[model samples]
Target: MAATEITLEVARYRPGVDSEPVLQSYQVPLREHWAILDGLTYVKDHLDGTLSFRWSCRMGICGSCGMTVNGEPQLSCATFLTDYAPGPIRVEPLHNFPVVRDLVVDIDDFMTKLPKVKPWVIREVQSPIEEGEYLQTPEEMDECQQFSMCINCMLCYSACPVYSLEPDFLGPAAIALAQRYNLDSRDEGADERRDVLSSPEGIWACTFVGECSAVCPKGVDPAGAIQRYKLTAATQSIKELLMPRSLIPRSKG
Candidate 1:
């Protein structure tokens, strides 16, 4: 029997150390069911200790293993080596973010944007805690269920061209999170968020390339959500002109 040899091309760079980021190659033996994270670990343990990357859950929950594998944002733990096995695999830091180290990126920008969107429920009506859990029928929950699956892996952010071209575009992940709360039946703050998201820094910046939906690991259609938000905002503008707030227009209401 012979060992299965795999070649990995990893992106490397260090501030004030390396002139520019370069791809460094490593060769290793792999098992049948080896994840991409295992390959990285093997290289770190035997080949190079200086290689920098991030990973927490060996499974796929934490989303810490997110990186661009051959130009696609993916979880190293979830992406199997055999799935892309021929000879060489290219691994690099996630895109649409500033690089902090080799495979590490500064997530402060992402965190700041996420919080700006208010990714939690904002209910105008506060019910008693003793009344039991916030009640939502299956249909109501379904409206925002897909948005809830976002693991914040930020693959959608990396895949978005709007983020790369215009860094202030509010991006996909934040927009999706905002939609998550807005679509909630218990939330009455959609109107409040519309002002912010309608700004130049928000959903209006998206050019509708639709790549965000394609790269999402959790099946969150961020592009669709943003488009729906745009539609809703447009509808509200027209309704406001034709009908006053005091008068009850059933469609606007």
Candidate 2:
């Protein structure tokens, strides 16, 4: 019997040397347990020293090794090579962002947008140390638990068609994280975040193509979060029209 072998068609781009990305192929031993990340490691260790990509934890938690596998955004650590066996597998950097190098897309866009959403519990005033920690019911925790699983892999951003078409869009992951903090029982910063999420470049820019949810390795449904926020925003608008300004809690910057 012969050992199984697989070919990887990896995209390569060197800043000044290459005009555009080109596919570079490498053959590696195929073990049923080996993932696409492992294949890349094999290439880096034994074959090519100059090849570049990002990875950490290799267990799918760090989310640093996201790339396009067969044209779909995936955490290479979680994607098994056996799934695309018997031939060459195509791997490339994530889409909708500037490529920094071979198989590494720049995440500066996400870093800029993520902070605007303030993906943490915000308070009008900090509790005194003697007051102890803020508490929440299980139900309150459950509300944002799923969205909190985001690993910031940028896979959702790469999968988002709206982000691809409109670079200014607030995007799925950031909006989802915003909702996560806003829904927290201890958070009082929803009003502070309202302007950002309600802006033209925010949730409204999302056309609900839902690809962001499809490629999420953590099962975080960013599309659903955006849709839910839309409903909340619309209802608030209706109330503002029918009621007095003093009766409603106006969102503050």
Top candidate by TM-score: 2
- Write candidate 1's Cα lDDT for 1-253 as tens digits: 5448888999998978987679999987767788889999999999999999999988888978889999899988988888777758999999988888999988888888888877887777888889978889999899899988998888888898889988778888888888998888878777667777888889889888999999888899999988988887778778788889667332210
Clashing residue pairs found in predicted model 1: none
lDDT by candidate, in order shown: 0.85, 0.91
Which consecutive 10 residues in model 1 have the weakest lDDT in total?
244-253
Model 1 / residue 194 / CA error / Å: 1.2
Model 2 residue pairs with clashes: none
Q: Give the lDDT of residue 242 in candidate 2.
A: 100
For candidate 2, write residues 127-191 as lDDT tens digits: 99899999999997998889899999989999888899899999999999999898888889887
What are the clash counts of all predictions, listed in order?
A: 0, 0
TM-score of 1: 0.93
Residue 90's lDDT within candidate 1 is 95
